[model samples]
Target: MDTAEPTTVGIINRENWIGALPAPVREAIEARMTRFTVAPGMPVKRAGEAATRIFQVETGFLSLIGLHVDGRQALITIYAAGNCFSETAMIVRREHNHTTIALTPAVVRQLERDDFWELYHRHPEIPEALCRKFAEAISRQMASREQRATQRLGQRIATMFANLAEHAGESVVGGETRILLPITQSNIADIFDVTRQSVHREVSHLKQLGIVDKRHGDWVVIDSERLRQICSY
Candidate 1:
């Protein structure tokens, strides 16, 4: 078991780290972690701000973003639960690498790089936790990345919906599969390396084709099997 020390009363949830690591390593990290939460649209890191901590999302989503000279920001990554981030700032403060924004009400556990390294050295498994989680759903992420890279906007959207059904989709009342797309259009653009207007038009096209539906800020896939056959994810 990790033998560092007792955890702080209200820092990171000890359970999460313990769950991610072997017993001993978990104990090591539990001694030096802290936790915090953020609301939707809040900045996790500001432009030109220093990077100081790394975070793992426990719930909801975070957007890694870069700003253009004109003060407009483009999404870079939409990080979901179990993803680690802010490594650049955690070890040494540098100019803000990217602006991180909360895409929804979110809970996160964080540690300064120094503390993180201390724990990481003791627990080799911590670094792999994100990969482990992603691996659990590898087929889906692979198909998604493939679509993002090789497919046109329409095909990307279609394959995404299809993959969701097999990966995270749930059956609805009419025996149709629904997958939640909690990400923003800007972030979708980032995934496909396309313009936001392009994504907007493609999404509109998908809607018209009855491939999916949006509800309460989430995209629910409607005809995933058909979508897969046609889109070829």
Candidate 2:
């Protein structure tokens, strides 16, 4: 997709790196930052590229894709609005480890490495806040790993759904939680290390249990309580 000027979605989350900055500091940093828009399926950063900037999603979603040894793609992670990514690579001055792509039309703000460090030096709290954030991320990763190793297939699928619903789902008129992101059987297969057919069967089971439903080419949580109880991992 092509880039365009930033759209107006005022900052909502105060915990992010940019949001944490004091008003004047934020203004100074915003003066140097570049805000742009991208269309769905557009490439953000390719794997092995020098990580010169970290991206914050003002709106829309980006999926991180990792290349498997067998020439396959794996969904490494998902970043939606209010999320900051590629900071680790920027910190270490290393290449991007995974390719990042827009999952929907996106408004993104990018901060260059030098600018990021400059902000850090300007505010001593920045590094501590960032460290806490990364620590939380690491904790989530550890929990996810544990769940993947021990959970049943159906439970794993349910957990994935629950996570998406919490992190990216939208509320509809009928009170159902709708996940607008593009998720396919192939994506699930790659994420859970299962076959496509297995994902299909598990999805069907979820439908049968009334835990989830398909709507408008996306998935919806029909009974979040049941889903949470069954897949509390």
Candidate 3:
């Protein structure tokens, strides 16, 4: 990874954590941030490593991987641009519980643990923003657990794609929406706690229905409404 000095302008905006802060507070936080770039397939932070910093993704996608004692790895989640993460580790003063790996060439900004506390104490808005972020994460976690418990395999898969299209999709030609992240069948399988073959079958079904397809190696939602309808049922 190559590190860069802080810039005068702040990158935080209303879309992400700490972005909703006042301009001066955002600038103050940005002043303490150091930017870095990571190559695809590189580990941004490893499990068991000291968590002395909080990170915000400026570009590209990252995978949060959870490792078990049985030597198994699971995809916990994906972090895209404008997402901030690792705050829990920093807050609890614990080592990272999961590994973060870059899925594509990514630019990230990190604020040291010490600087983070200083800002937290100095700015009242910081804690409020963090609380909101944590709440959102918890809500998503609960929804995911519910989804895994109550939904069928195919329904879960469709719901995952629909959620991705809403959160991380870019409009493409011909009314299609392409998922911005470079995700694989294995990744989807990991997220759903299912086998890759199972995911492949569901993906094939979606393709046959003309609801989704791959274009230029990216997953495209051909009919967003139809995909959502699949999720609804």
Candidate 4:
């Protein structure tokens, strides 16, 4: 658990789900949210814990990790700044299905389940908006699964980098896109259920082609158009 101090202001971001709400509703929700900071590698929520709050990332990256009965763990997904998650569990009144850990120093805002319901009751648009968000999320997950199932290893790796660049990349000098998050070959291997060496091979090939490179420990998409062409199926 994080013991960081919590604040009540500056919680709304137009990019996040909460910002889609009506102005009055956004203010109400913000009033109920508590923003706090989390250190890298710290657990935000763990499996089997009651889903008492819904979280929105303000900054940094968080990885959702799922565990298998045989003691194996898999990376479900990574959430970046301006993303909201864990609503499904809270809505269903069930325990969290996965563990969320900070991949970098993060700032997050959480709204308690009871407060969420209060707002839900008052605002009719809330559920409809959430339904649309859930649908989009499911569509992305299905596409990712399909890619993993049918795409060649190199294509899969390329596609992964392209998607990550969209989600976490920032434009830099020379038109390159730098993925701000710390992603490793091992993390890619976990996502595709492949060995780290295999992921390294694909990454090295991309590096050799000058489609991607690393700068200051972050992955940089040197040639975004070329990467897209490679990932196109």
For all candidates, what are the clash counts?
3, 0, 0, 0
RMSD of 1: 7.8
- Please provide TM-scores, in order, for all candidate models, with all chains considered together: 0.68, 0.84, 0.85, 0.84
lDDT of each residue in 1-233, candidate 4, tens digit only: 21112111111112356766677877787889999999988999999999999998877888888875787777767876767888999898999989999988999999998999999888887887688677766666676667667889998788778877876779999999998777777777877878989999999999999999987899999999999999886
lDDT per residue (tens digit) for residues 1-233 in model 3: 11222211111111376666688888898899999999988998999999999998888878889865788777777776777888999888999989999977999999999999999999999998788777766766676677778888898888778867876788978889998777789877877778899999999999999999988899999999899889889
Which one is best on lDDT?
3
Output candidate 2 Cα RMSD.
6.1
How far does residue 32 in candidate 1 sit from its true spot (Å)? 2.1
Per-residue lDDT tens digits for candidate 1, residues 1-233, read: 12122221110112233355676766566557677889998987776876666676767667778866787777665665655666645545576777788876888777776787777576668767634443544554565565556767787656545644553456888767665435567766765667889989988887888877787766677766667766754
TM-score of 3: 0.85
CA lDDT of every candidate: 0.63, 0.78, 0.80, 0.79
Model 1 residue 168 lDDT score: 45
Candidate 4: misplaced stretches above 4 Å?
A: 1-15, 68-72, 171-173
How would you encode candidate 2's per-residue C-alpha lDDT over 1-233 as one tens digit per residue? Answer: 11222211111111255566566766676677799998998989999999989888888888889887998888866776767788889888899988989989999999888888988788776677678767766766676777777889888888778878876789987778998888888888888888999999999989998889997798999988999898764
Answer with 3 or 4, whichever has the higher lDDT: 3
- Segments in model 2 whose C-alpha atoms lie over 4 Å from true places: 1-15, 21-27
Residue 186, candidate 2: alpha-carbon lDDT:
87
